[model samples]
Target chain A: MLTALARDLAAPLAANGSFLIKPGVGLMVWTLLVFGLTMVLLSKLAFPRISAALERRQKAIEESIDTAERTRAEAEQILAEYRQRLQEARAQADEIIQRARQTAEVQEREAKERGQEIVAEASQRAQREIEAATKRALEELRNEVADLTITATEKVTRKALDPEDQKRLVEEALREMDFSGLSSGASNN
Target chain B: MNATETGGLPPRPAPEEARIPAPHPTDDPAPKSSVKRKLLIALGVYLAGLIALIAIYGFKGHRNELFKPQNEFKLESWVDLGIFSINKAVLYLFIAAALTCVTMIYIARRMQQRPNKVQAAVEALFRLMHDNITASAMDERMAAKWFPFIGTLFLFILFSNLVGYIPLPTNTENEINVFGLQIPSFSLYAATANLSVPLVLALTVFVSYTVEGIRAKGPIGYLKGLIPGGVQGGMAVPIFFLEVLSNLMRILSLTIRLFANILAGHLIILFMAGALAVILGSAWLGWFTLPFGIILFAFEVGLVAALQAFIFATLTAIYLGGAVAKDH
Candidate 1:
C-alpha cells in the first residue's frame, strides 16, 4: 500500500520536477549574478558620489549655519548698541527741547513787560502836553476878548459925539484900565 | 494675563513627587520613567492566561497524552508538490506572508499619514535593522542595497518563530484517514521544527554573502583573501588549506546556530507545556510552578524570537560588511 502511494506520488512529481529545477536553478543563478553585478556597480560608481555629495552638503550646511549664527550675533550686538544710543539721544533731545521751551517762555515775558512800559510812558507824556496847551490857550483867549470889547465901544462913541466928547470918553477908559491892571497884578502874585 | 489664572500653573505635585521625578516613559519619552508597569501588565496578562491553561491541563493529569508523539496526515502522494510545499508548518509561511503583506502595506499606507502602534513597531524594527545593525557596520548607501534581503529574512524568521508559542491545536490525538486507515496526526508544529526550513534560510545567506564577496573583490581577489598575508612558500600552502577549512566551517556554523536555537526553543516549550499538568499536582504546587512555567515560557518565546531575528540579521550584515570591505 505504501509502495502504491509512493508510485502514485512519483509520476506527477517526476514530470514537473525537471521543469521546476531548470527554471529554479537557472533563475536563481541569474538573479545571483545580477545582484552581485549590481552591488559592484553601486559600490564602485554610485555610492562614492552619493557619500561625497552628502559629506559636502553636510559641511556646507554647517558652514552656512555658522555664518548665519555669527551674522545674527553681530546684528544683535549692533542692535543693542543702536538701541542704547537711540535712547540716550532721545533723552538729550528732550532735555534740549525742554530748555529751549523754557528760554522762549522767559523771552516772551520780557518782551511783553517792555511793551507795557513803553505804552505807559507815551500815555503820561501826552497827558502832560495836553494840560500845558489847554492852560496857555485859556489865557490867550481871555486877553483877546477884552481888547475887542474896548475897540467896539470906542467906535460907537466916536460916531455919536463930537471931538470934545471923545476926549472925555478916552479919559474914563484910561482910568478903568489902570484899576484893572492893579487887580490883574494882585491875582498873578 | 498671568499663568496661574488660566490654570496653567505648574501642578502642585504630591509628596511622592520626590520618588517619581518625571512622568512615565510611555507617557512622555522626554524623561526616563519606569515602563515597569506597562511591561509588567503585558507580561502579567500573558502569564495569567498561560498559567490558567496549564493548571486546567495539570488538574486533569493529561501529561502522558499531551507529550505523546503519533505520526499522522503526512502526504505520501504527488498531490503535495507544487510552487508551495504543503504541510502544517507551511501554514506558518501563509502567516508570514499575511503578516508581511498586511503589516507592510498597512504600515506603508498609514506611514503616509500617521503610523499605528503595530506599524510603528515594525518600522522601528526595520530601522534598527537597517541603521544600527546594517548601516553602522557598512556605509549607509551600501547598507541600503542589502536592506531588503536582510530585512525580509529577519521579519519572516521572527514572525514564524513567534507563532510557535501561540498554543495552536497541535495534539497527536487528532485522527485522519490515510490509505484506508485512521492515523493520529500532529496538527500544529513550528515552522522551524524541521531543520530544512532554517537550512534553506542559511543557504540563502550563504549564496548572498558568497555572491557579494565575489562581486566586491573580484573572483581572483576573493580567492586570494583565503591566503594569509605575508606567508612564505611552505607556510602559505598549510595556511591556505586552513582558510578553506574555516570558510567551510562558517557555512556550517551559521546554518546550525539559527536551526539549533529555534529547534531547541520549540522542544523546550513543548515539554514544559506538555508536562505542566503533572507538575501542578497540588494547589500550592500549581501556584508556584504554574507562574514559573508560564513566566519562563513567555520570556523564552519573546527572547528566542527577538534574539534569533537579531542573530540572523547580524550575521548577514557582518557577511555583507566583510564582502564590501574596500580597505581589507
Candidate 2:
C-alpha cells in the first residue's frame, strides 16, 4: 500500500505532473473545512476574550487614572480651604487679644478716674466737716461768751439782757457764717 | 535516457532505471548520526520543501539526491494527491491544528487582569497581531471588528508554518511485513508548503473581504463603488469593470505569493542539504558546505516561519481596509 502510494506520488512529479499543475480539489476543500472550523472556533473561543481582556484592562487603567486625578484635585482644594481657615483663625485670635488689651486699658482708665473723683469728694467732705467743727466751736464760744457776759452782767446788768435777743444774736451770727464760700475757698487752698 | 520523450506528450512511465546508473555505496548520503551530515541534510530538506521543483526527484534509497542534475523533487505521499489520496501533510495539519487549539484554550481560560509572565507574553503577542496587522491597516473601529478574524488567521498560519519545521521520520523505504502484506511508513510534510492550503486560505480572505464590501455598501452600491470617482460617461463602465478585475486579481496574487514564498524557502533549504550530500561523495569535502547550510536552515526555520504568516495577515488586513473604505 505504501509503495502504491509512493508510486502514485511519483506519477505526479513525473516529466509533466498532469495532475500537479492543477491544485487538488480535495485538499483545498479539506483546508477550507479545517480553516473554517479553526477560524470559527478561534474567533468564538479565543479572539473575543483576547480583545475584550485588552479593552477591559485599558478601561480599568483609564478609570484608575481618572480616580487618582479626581482625588488629587479634591485633596488640593481641601488643603487650600484648610490653609485659608487657619489664616482666618490666626487673625481672629489676634483680634481677640487686641480687644482684650483695649478693654483692660479702658477699665483701668475708668477705675483711675472714679478713684480720683472719690478722692476729690472725700477731701470736700473733710473740709465741710472741719468748717462745721469750727462753726460748732464758734457757736459754743459764743454761747460761753454770752453766758459769761450774761453772768457778768447779771452780776452788774445781766438782769437787763433778754434771753430771746441772745438766742437771736447767736442764730444770726451762725447764719452769717456761709460755709459754701468758705469750704470752696478751703477746697481751693 | 528517455530525455527525448518530452513533458508535452502525456506522461508514460518509462523505466528510468536503465539510463540512470545504479547508485554506488559512495553515491548515497552520509549517516545522520554525524553532526555535519545532519545539519547539511536538514538544510537541504528545508530547501527542498519550498518552490516548484522542476526535476528534483527525491533520494534513491538513501542516496545524495541533492545536486543530481536530472532529479525531480520527491513528492512523498503518506497518502497521494493526484489520486485524491490523503497525504502526511493532512495528518501534520491536524496535529498542528490540535496543538494550537489546546494551547490557545489553556492560555485563554487563565487570562487575567493582572497577568502572570506567560499571560503577559501571550497578551503581547496577541496585541502585536492587532497592532501589526489590523490597526496598522484600518481605522480603530474596523480594527476592533476585524481583529478576531485577522488575529486568528495570523496565529493559525504561524503555528501551521512553524510546526512544519519539526523533523519527521525520513521516508526511506521501510518494511514491516504483516501476514504477507508489506506495510510502508512515511514522514509528514508541512501543510503550508501545499498550494491547496494557501489557496483555501486565500479564498477565505477573498470571500470575507468581498462580503465586507457588500455589507458596507449594499450589493448594488458595492458594484457601483468599484468605479473610479472621477470617471464619467461610458469610460466609467469600462474602468469599473477593470477595477473589479483588479480587485479579483487580489485573490490569485495572495494565494500564489504565500505558496511560492513557502515553496521557494523549502526548495532552497533542501537544495543546500542535497548539495552537501553530493559533496560528501568526495571525502572531507562535504564539511566545507556545513556552516552555510546550517545557518540558512536555522534562519528560515526561525525567521521565515513568523514572517510569511505576518505578510499574509497584513495583506489580508489591507484588502479588508480597501473593501470597507468610505470613498470606495
Candidate 3:
C-alpha cells in the first residue's frame, strides 16, 4: 500500500517544480543563496548590540563602585565632624567652670578683709568711750569725798593729811584707768 | 588610670579607624544572559531574512526571463596564463575570490578599533573556523601557524559552494556572453557542486601533508614512518611499501568522498525540483514541488557545506598531527 502511494506521489512530484532542485545549476543556486545570504545577514545585524550591552554593563559596574567609595568617604567626614564638635563643647564647658571657680575665690578673700577692718574700728571706739566714762566717775567721786573730807578735816584738824597717803591714792586711780581700757577692748572684740 | 590602659584608650580614637567599604557583589551574570539574548535575536533576524527572500521569490512566482530554459554554446578563443587556460571557470573563480577578499578586508578593517555587529559576526565565523576546524584537531599553536592556508581553504570552498545558487548575470540557463565567450553563462553550480573543485582541494591537502611530512621527518624518515615496528627481515620492506601505497590511497578516497557528497546533494535537490516541470506541462507542478524541495535543499546544502569543510580540515589536522607525532 505504501509503495502504491509513493508511486502515485512520484508522478505528481515529477510534475511539480523540480527544476528548483536540479543537480548542476539548480542545486548550486540554492546552496549559494542559503549560505551566502545567511552569512551576510548574520554579519550585518546581530553582534554590535551584544558588544555594546556588555560594555555598558561593565561601565555601570565601575561607576557603582566609584559611588560606593564616595559614600564611604562622606560617612567618614560626618564621623570626623561629630568628633570635632564633641571636643569643642567639652573644652568650652571646662573654661566656664574654671572662670566661675576663680570669681568665687576672689570674693571670699575680699569678704574676709572687710570683716577684720570692721572689728578693728569697733575696738578703738570702745576704748575711747571707756576712758571718757572713767574720767567722769572719778570727778563725781572726788566732789562728794571732798565735802566729807572738809568736815572731817575741821573736826579732826589737829593732824593735816600726810604726803605718803596722798601719793598712794593717786597711784590707785591710775591703775583703775588701765584696767578699764583693757575691759573695753575685750568687749568690742 | 593604669598607664597601659590610658595609652590604649587614647589609641581608641585613632584616625585609621574609618570603616572599610564592603566589596561590591560581582555575582551578576548579566553578560552571560546578554550573550544568550543576543544569539536569540540573531537567530530571529536570520530567519526573518530567509522569510523575506522567500517572499520576494514567491511574489515573483519564482520565474524570471533568464531562468527560461534554453541551451546553446559558442566556442571562444582562450587566453593562456602560462600553466593553464584562463577559461570561464577560472574567471568565475577570480570574481568570487575577489568578492570574498573584499568582504573579508572590509570586516577586518572595521574591526581594528571595535567590532560592530557585522564585524563581530564575521570575526566569530573566523574564530569558529579556527577553533572547530583547525585547533580542535591539532595543537592550537600549530593551528595558528597554519591558519591562513587552512582558513582560506575552508572559506573559499564554502563560499564557492554557496555562490553556486546566486542567479548571476553569467548564470542563466540559456547562452550568454562572458569574457568574450558565447557560452552557457549562468549554470547554477557551486564550484564544490562540481567534482573537480573538491578533487582539486583534496589534491592540495595531499600535497601539503606530503611536503609537511618530509619537512618534519626528513625524506628517509617519512618513508620509514609507513612501516610498523617488529617486522622481521624482508617482510619489513613489503610492509613499508604497502603502507606507503595505503597512505596514497587515503588521499584519493578523501578527495572522492568530498566531491561525491557535494555532487550527490546538488543532484538530489536538482532532480527533486526538476520533477515538477518534467512531469507536468503546467507551472503548478513547480509550486507543488517547491516547499519540499526548498526544505530539503536547505538541510542538504547546510550539511554539505559544513561537512565538506569539516572533513577537509579534519584530514589535514590528522596528517599534520601524524607528521609531528613524537612516536612516529
Across A49-140, the per-residue lDDT of candidate 2 in tens digits comes to 77788899999999999999999999999999999999999999999999999999999999999999999999989878877777676567
Q: Write the residue-wise lDDT of candidate 3 on B178-232 in tens digits.
A: 6887775444455564444555556667777778778878888887775776676
- The best candidate in terms of DockQ: 2
Query: What is the per-residue lDDT of model 2 for residues B1-328, given as tens digits with 9 covering 90 to 100?
Result: 2545665666566578866887896656644347687787867774554322312433322333333311222345565556455665566567667777777767887778999998898888888888978998899998988887788788778888777766565333444566996664333246777777888888889898999999999898888888867778989988988998988788788877777776656655654544434522422223334556567778877888888888889999998998888777
Grade the docking of candidate 3: incorrect
Predict model 1's lDDT versus the native. Answer: 0.59
Q: Scoring only the second chain, what is candidate 3's TM-score?
A: 0.65
What is the per-residue lDDT of model 1 for residues B1-328, given as tens digits with 9 covering 90 to 100?
Answer: 4668659986665578577767665676533334676777867876776578556655343223222221221222222554443445455555654564455544444442244576557556756776777887778777878776676666666776777666554443565678987665444355554455665666678778778878888888876766756776888788878877876676777667776676556544543444333332333234444455666678867697778878877888887787667543
Where is model 3 more than 4 Å wrong at Cα?
A1-189, B1-83, B171-173, B176-186, B228-239, B279-285
User: Model 2, residue B22: displacement in angstroms?
Assistant: 69
Give the number of the best model, judged by lDDT. 2
After superposing candidate 2 on the true structure, give the runs of residues whose Cα lies further than 4 Å from its correct spot: A1-22, A89-189, B1-75, B79-84, B135-146, B170-189, B218-220, B273-275, B279-286
- Better candidate number, 2 or 3, judged by TM-score: 2
TM-score of chain A of each: 0.57, 0.51, 0.39
TM-scores, one per candidate = 0.53, 0.60, 0.47
